[model samples]
Target: MNNKLFSVIFSLAVAIALVGPLFAAGGGTALQHANVNVRDTAAVQRGAKLFVNYCLSCHSASYMRYNRLAEDLGLDEELVMDNLVFADVKIGETMDIAMRPADAEAWLGKVPPDLSLISRSRGADWLYTYMLTFYQDESGGWNNLALPNVSMPHVFWQLQGIQKPVYATHDGIEVVDHLTLGKPGLQSPEEYEGTVRDLVTFLDYLGEPAKVKRKNVGVWVLLFLALFALIAYALKAEYWRDVH
Candidate 1:
């Protein structure tokens, strides 16, 4: 009944109201674990290569510089320029697409989104699941369980092959029970999964290049705080001993 108690209750209610939608949005299939490790330098390197080959033509990581990526992933400047640099861009330049926005819109009916911060916004698991769940619909177009009716085609179909969805009725509504490989691709399923994992790992790194450094520094900061706290406690006790 007091003003302070009423304010606390109102804050809690507002928090619940804001967070309710996130919980409600979990009605679809459970997201699979991405298991991305940004510390795996080889994996990130491979992911960077894959991104440049398959995704760079459409979606650009415009916020990230090629030289920065090389430094983070421990790649040589010349090697990056020779292999990863398809466009006539300098090593210090940002990863931008050559495709015009108008051309992309006309071709795909929508512009593909920039992926610099996609891992941060969508999470690694969602990206992993989205990458793997592409299936050939009855109409012969590509669809995904993670994002149904998406405009993006199965760009990795040659690597992952054709996947078909098994339908089952869920409360009188038909839904995909699971995906089965209808046709094998160039790589085995395990290989494809590993490739996707590597790509996701690279994306995770791109989202926050300083994440590992920050975590390492945080440990030292905590240790210093603990030591300081103990020292402060000892000083306080010594100062109060004579007074007591």
Candidate 2:
């Protein structure tokens, strides 16, 4: 029974490991790994800057405060206020946008959702791929392979340039084969990828600010457990020696 149970558990674990990436991709498109490290304060800071300049006007990170951001990224409060705080918001205030919901809905056809937990809801890999996959559709409008018919426009076009989709027939229906850069952007492809990576890294940090500290604590806890187990085993051996 023990062996049977172990086999079943192992099989389930293997299956889950194999299938997990497909679900993370969302909508059948393979996701690019974000390879983000929230512990990298410099990357997080760059991502935060990009978020504020590009995404903040539409999406608000209401859960995160400017003071907390400054503290986490090791920035002086004054520097954050001068650089990051675009609106007339106080340093202690949450990162709320000036755009009213009604106005945003009228302009965008929908109120942009708050992005405080976007990375948690849609994993970092999905977000990273989504950022990179925006392409010019036949209608000359922006579309994404990661999220078909995405309402958002290609906001990073200036940096990453225009990507045109290449289509190929598969089973009588045309499908996107790949994307090609038709126009060059300000940054090289490598530099643009790095920029997107930094942005995703910030989003990842935003989702769970305590992740770094929690991971550190977990390592210490595992070490303590191993030490305790060793001590317990030594006591057990000494106690049994007399009886033997």
Candidate 3:
């Protein structure tokens, strides 16, 4: 009886120990790494440029229309045409990627994530952290899931530098001690953060294309209701004496 009780206690303790990190990082839910600064208009513009230059080739944001972006953002059609709009897509076309999913799985060992609803699905902080947290763990075979033996090689290693997550324990708490860049990337830390913020903004925009418009219209709707109520009250007062 004592041995059985010990086994149960041991199992419970092991389970708690194993699942602790899961809760800390949002309970093993979808990747929620992002530092999305949607309010930064300039940063969003910069991020759009960065994403077009780097990320658009693999992943497609199918829901967003170029025309929508232009109308909402007041973008110059000529500039987007010359610079950000690649793949021979028209100025009014929907955003899409050239990469096929089957080929991507063969190449990267997993399908690339869609960015359309990523901000909604994973949250901004998750996207931000994911962008920043990639590191070199030599054993990660194919797909990396904290399993050191990952096969997927770092695609952005050159841009972000080769990172290896430094692990440490203090006061019995394990942590991702640090991220050290072994090689140089195209951008510095501040530059990279801005870049990530840009992507986050874009993702946020994609997630809710009508958000800005809705917010702008919401105020007017409320004002209309208040004005309508005042007029209604005045009408009621004006009619009150007619029968009398």
| Per-model CA lDDT versus the true structure | 0.91, 0.92, 0.71
TM-score of 2: 0.84
Model 2 poorest ten-residue lDDT run: 21-30
| TM, every model | 0.83, 0.84, 0.68
lDDT of 3 by residue, 118-187 (tens): 7787667666766665676656422232323334455555667667667789799875566677666998
Query: Ten consecutive residues with minimal summed lDDT in candidate 1?
Result: 21-30
**Against the true structure, candidate 3 has what lDDT?**
0.71
What tens-digit string does per-residue lDDT give for candidate 2 at 1-244? 5999999999999999999967866666788888998888899999999999999989999999999999988899999998998798899999898889999989877788999999998999899999999999999988999988888888999999999999999999999999999998999999999999999999998999998678778899999999999999999999999999
lDDT tens digits by residue: candidate 1, 1-244: 9999999999999999999756643427678898998878899999999999999999999899999988887788999999899899999999999999999999998899999999988889889989999999999999998888889998999999999999999899999999999999999999999999999999999999997567678889999999999999999999999999
Q: Over the full model, what C-alpha lDDT does candidate 2 score relative to the true structure?
A: 0.92
Give the candidate number with the greatest lDDT.
Answer: 2
Q: Is candidate 2 or candidate 3 better by TM-score?
A: 2
